[model samples]
Target: MAATEQPISYAQDIKPLFREGDRESMSAAFDLWSYDDVVQNSDAILGKLRDGTMPCDGAWPEEQVDLFQRWVDAGMPA
Candidate 1:
């Protein structure tokens, strides 16, 4: 099966997207590595990713952003 054809889960697909630095940088606001935190702020996070304002350093690539959107669309499975 193709990558997009498979189910997306937080542990396997979503959480790994956030690097250590990312977790640290966003720590003051939220825990990027935490499922609850991510799900709670998904919309705002998606907006930032779409607008190229996340990471506080640089924007994620189009594919990464799209993957994130897909996870959200999938009901943010854990």
Candidate 2:
């Protein structure tokens, strides 16, 4: 976990997980555009990420996934 106890910000943390083309490519199926959208669908997001079923290319780095989980566990902080 990160040393700082500050809550994760979607803009700072989660949004970066998606790539430059992600919004265009995954638009039809998924949208990681804003905080509310993510917080509302956090369960599905975590599930897919945990199971290595997201990104459509490969699993995220362990640390990245861990960080995301921390965000979720922290009540999906903004």
Candidate 3:
């Protein structure tokens, strides 16, 4: 984290990245909106995101993926 960089949190940052349909589609696997689930599965999720295999509709923008990676690297905060 840089001096001016704000910390990332699940509620304020990561959770909103998953859409309602995303949560519905991934319900069988895990709840995308759940902090614990996400934290547990963050690595696999990041791999899928990086490879454009998540969301199942289309890949997220590079910036969004980068944001996710940043959150993960930042200790999967909150």
Candidate 4:
């Protein structure tokens, strides 16, 4: 977790986990477009978090993980 990182904005919650260049994780990867287009498809990003496929290499903490799931379940707020 970075010093100023937010809890679970897609940018804050998910991007830091994987190789952004790849959008893949220890569990699985999204489509090619997902990796390339995170800004427009935050739900896809949240899908990864909701299913607990993120925080790879243990980069994210439980609270952030909770936030990720909540954000997704809440319809991925803008």
**Cα lDDT over the full model 2:** 0.80
Highest-scoring model, lDDT: 1
Model 3, runs deviating above 4 Å? 1-3
lDDT for each residue of candidate 4 in 5-38, tens digit (9 for 90 to 100): 4444555545554454454433253443343455
lDDT of 2 by residue, 1-78 (tens): 358987787888889887877667667766788677777778888888889888778888888888899988887767
What's the true lDDT of residue 67 in model 3? 89
lDDT of each: 0.93, 0.80, 0.91, 0.51
- Clashing pairs for model 3 are none
Model 3 TM: 0.93
Using lDDT as the yardstick, the better of models 2 and 3 is 3
TM-score of 4: 0.37
Per-residue alpha-carbon lDDT of candidate 1 for residues 6-65, written as tens digits (9 for 90 to 100) = 999999999999999999999999999999999999999999999999877999999999
Per-residue CA lDDT of candidate 3, range 1-78, in tens? Answer: 344588988999889999999999998999999999999999989999999998789999998999899999889889
Q: What is the lDDT of candidate 4?
A: 0.51
Every model's TM-score: 0.93, 0.82, 0.93, 0.37
CA lDDT of 66 in candidate 4?
Answer: 66
